[model samples]
Target: MSKICEICGRKPHAGNQISHSAKKSTRWWHPNIQKVRVKLPDGRVKRMKICTRCLKAGKVQKAVS
Candidate 1:
């Protein structure tokens, strides 16, 4: 699964991690993406990778287990 939100288009952000000694280390802030099944406009359920924020915001309807 890709690290992208199908609903909000959220992607991984690059940044640095600062240590106590003022040392900087490169890192990535990846979104909390999950594979889920969403209902499409045509009533077809499709699987996609979406971030937790979008899921919490109800941007897409998750498929019933």
Candidate 2:
């Protein structure tokens, strides 16, 4: 799946992993995204990749299982 959130547009962020020995390595920080059924304003439900943060914040209408 794509490493991008369809709701918030959150994507993988570039960062560094620092070791205890002062060594750094390139790494990617990705959001916790899940494929969920979302309800749209037009009363259409569609599957989309949404981050957990948006779910917690109630930014979009989630389809009932």
Best by TM-score: 2
- Candidate 2: tens digits of C-alpha lDDT, residues 1-65: 99899888999999889999989999989999998899999999999999999999999999887
**For model 2, what is the error of residue 9's alpha carbon versus the real structure, in angstroms, after optimal superposition?**
0.8
Clashing pairs in 1: none
- The segments of candidate 2 whose C-alpha lies over 4 angstroms from its true place after superposition are none
Pairs that clash in candidate 2: none
> All predictions: root-mean-square deviation over Cα?
1.1, 0.9
lDDT of 2 at 65: 78
Question: What is the lDDT for 47 in model 2?
Answer: 95
Q: Residue by residue across 1-65, what tens digits does model 1's lDDT show? A: 67988788889889999999999999999899998899887889999998899889888998786
Ten-residue segment with the worst summed lDDT in candidate 1? 1-10
lDDT of each: 0.88, 0.92
